[model samples]
Target: MSTLLLGVNGQVGHELRRALAVHGALLAPPRTRLDLTDLAAVDDFLHQHQPDTIVNAAAYTAVDKAESETALARRLNTELPDLLARYSADHEAVLVHYSSDYVYPGDGDQPWHEDSPTGPLSIYGQSKLDGDEAIARRGCSHLIFRTSWVYSARGSNFLKTMLRLGGERDSLAIVADQVGAPTPARLIADASVHALRRYREAAELGGLYHLAPRGVTSWHGFACEIFRQARHAGMALAIAPERVSAIASDDYPTPATRPLNSRLELSRLENAFALELPDWQSQLSLTLHDLLP
Candidate 1:
């Protein structure tokens, strides 16, 4: 049973390759090898690979910059997956894809469930939501895992940014209004592997699931923890520990509007897969251990 993995260089893709070591053959092409932006190339790759399962972790994740590149972002995020979904349906292959918590407007205090009303605030979010709809409409055997605030030791994420900035400035101001779990990419990959097994076991085990590390935190709180862990690791920093001040989201305006609540409920994942996710603090500690300079 051959499995083809897309976006193997991305954060979740890299970790997924590790988690799915025993799954089967994996085929991930770098951008130079195959540009998913080319719809025909994507279709040809799917047809040639003839994979039993295809995991798409690739996404146009430039949140602020995506405001200007709406068309390209939609092509990569929505159209690419729509093609994959059609292929998977035709070939009878299981398709696994990753999505974002940004699908929700983040206006409410309650955690979002799998069936929540999706109202994306940014072009990035709208593009992802459109892709989700495309996959569902294709009627393929697929699993879509929606996650948020993903960080890894190797990627350009919040943790890395905080550590870099912590070394250059005497003080820092982070948006405190934004709330979500600082989910480690490894956790998302691991859960994907588990869901893959369940997919193989039962044909009916295919749907959208909210996969995130347990607990909730504001951006400021998450940043504070990152710095605290860096300090405990004996890492030097230019910013004083107390200099990390909390500010509202308005302080850091960007091209795309952000959701105030990025939190997602994982009851469906837990109930269906019988998997227990680690606390966000634990996941952060593990990721920081490798990233702190």
Candidate 2:
């Protein structure tokens, strides 16, 4: 059974390529060979490859830009998944998709369950919701993992951005109101493989599950932790020790409104897979080690 992994160049997709290599044939084509924006091209590729499993990691992740690029965002985030789900249903293929917590309303301090009511705040969030809805409505054998605050040792993310800015500036003002776990791309990829194996063992385990680390923290808390770990790792930065200031989400304005609450309940995933996810801080340490020289 061949597996087709999309977004192989992305942070999560890059890690997935390595984590999933031992399973079977992983057909991870680069954008130079396949443009996902083109629905016709994607359909053709699906028909030609006929992969038993389709892992969709590619998405229109430009949250702020997506407000203006509505059509393109819908194409990649909604229509693409719709086509893939239809194909999966017809061909008896399994789909593994990575989704965001932005699909929620971004209110309340309580963690969102897998079956929580969804009310998206932005065009990007709505697009993802549409995609998820399409996948579920198709009734195909699928696994939709909703996660948030994703960062990594590689690629452009909050962790890397803070490291670079901290090294160059004396102080930074980070948004502290928003709260969620900082998920590593490596962890997401690894959990996916584990969940897939468990799904094979119990067919009933096939459905939506929230995927994230155990604990949660605000962006300010995460930045402070990052700085602390960087200093502990002997990395010199221009930012003074504990010089980061906490600011409200309103202070940090963006074209797209960010969800204040991104906390996703992991019991469904942990119970289903019999796994205990590590905390965000510890995961940050591993990613820090890989990132800092």
Candidate 3:
């Protein structure tokens, strides 16, 4: 089967290319070749490629900037997925799309189910929700995996940012109010491959599922662990454990309001795929190993 993988340059997309290549012929285009910002260009590329399967991992991920760049964010996070879902519906193809936990309102301490009441706090979150709703409404064969706090060894993410700042500065102030799992991009790709294989075995498996590690922590907790692991691995760092302080989300105001609760329930994904996901700490350890020299 011909699989068209979008966002090959992204954290998840980069990993998807590696895992999906073994399954089938993969078509991953660079932005220079086909600019996704151009809707007509995206539609044209879809027709030209005529893929049997499409995996979209690309997203407009600048949370704060998305407030002002609503049109651009909507184009990528909403319109692009809409176009792809339309194609999947008409051609009878399977679509595997990535979504965010920001779709849920950051109110309670409980983990959000796949069918949780969505109340996005920012333009980025709303756009992602819109894309997901569009795909569902299209009534196409699809699998939507909503993940949280994605980071990888290779990408510019929270993990890398902490490592750099930890080494350069003596201390850092991280928001502790927001809580969620730090899902590795590699894990997401592996699970996607497993879900696709299982979905092929039984088509009824296609639908929305929350994909994340088993446990959860706040952004401050995540940064502390990152420093701890990096130090344990004998990596150089200037930040002291005590100096790394935790603050509330309100202390660090940005253009976009962040959801305090990003915890997603993984029972649906686990039961459906029959896989045991690792905890956030263990996942961070593996990613740090890959990153630290």
Candidate 4:
């Protein structure tokens, strides 16, 4: 099967490039060559290439910046997916898309289910939700994985930011109210490959599923764990674990209102695919090993 992976340079896409390659011939075009924002060009490329599987991992991920740059966010997060869904429906190809847990209302403590009522708090979240809806409305064979707090050793994410701050600063403050799993990009890539295999074997497996590592923690808790793992990995840090203060979301204000509850239920994913996802801490430790020198 010919597989076309977009956003190969992104956190999740980078790992997907390797994982998806083993399944089939992978065509991961650079942004300079394939501009997903340009609908005409993307449509032409899809028609010309006619890839059997299209994995869209590209997204405008700047949560705060998205408030001001709504158009750009919509183009990437909403319009691009709509275009891809249309193409997938026309060509009868499978489209694998990644979504965020931010689509749910952030007020609750309960883990979001696949059928949870969505009430996006920020522009970024709304755009992602719109993209998910567009894909579903297209009536195409697709798999939408709603994940949360994604990070990787290679990208600019929370883990990397904390590592840098810990080494340079004497103290740091992290929000403690927000809670979610810090899912590693590697896990997402691996799960995507596994799900793709299942879909190939049985077409009925194509649908929305939450694909995050097990367990949950606050932002402060996640940061503390990152430092703990970094120190265990022999990485030097100026700031001690206790030096990181746990602050409320109000203390660190951003343009976009963040979701306090990002926990997503994974029983659907586990039972459907017969796969066991590791805990958040286990995956975070592995990623820290990769990240630390």
- Deviation of model 3 at 166, angstroms: 0.5
Selected candidate, larger lDDT, 1 vs 3: 3
- The list of candidate 4 runs beyond 4 A from truth reads none
lDDT of each: 0.90, 0.92, 0.93, 0.94
**Higher-lDDT candidate among 1 and 4?**
4
Model 3 segments more than 4 A misplaced = none
**TM-score for candidate 4:** 0.99
Q: For candidate 3, lDDT tens digit of each residue in 1-293? A: 89999999999999999999898799999888889999999899989889989999988999999999999999999999999999999999999999999898989899898988999999999999999999999999999999999999887999999999999999799999999999999999999999999998899899999999988899999999999999999999999999999999899999999899998999999998899998989989998999866
* Between candidates 1 and 2, the lDDT winner: 2
Encode model 4's per-residue lDDT on 1-293: one tens digit a residue.
79899999999999999898788688999899998889899999999999989999999999999999999999999999999999999989999999999899887799999998999999999999999999999999999999999999997999999999999999999999999999999999999889989989999888999999999999999999998888888999999988999999999999999999998999999988999999999999888888655
Task: List, residue by residue over 98-160, the lDDT tens digit for candidate 1.
Answer: 899989999979999889899999999999999999999999999999999989999799988
Task: Name every residue pair that clashes in candidate 3.
Answer: none
- CA RMSD of all predictions: 1.0, 0.8, 0.7, 0.7
**Better lDDT candidate (2, 4):** 4
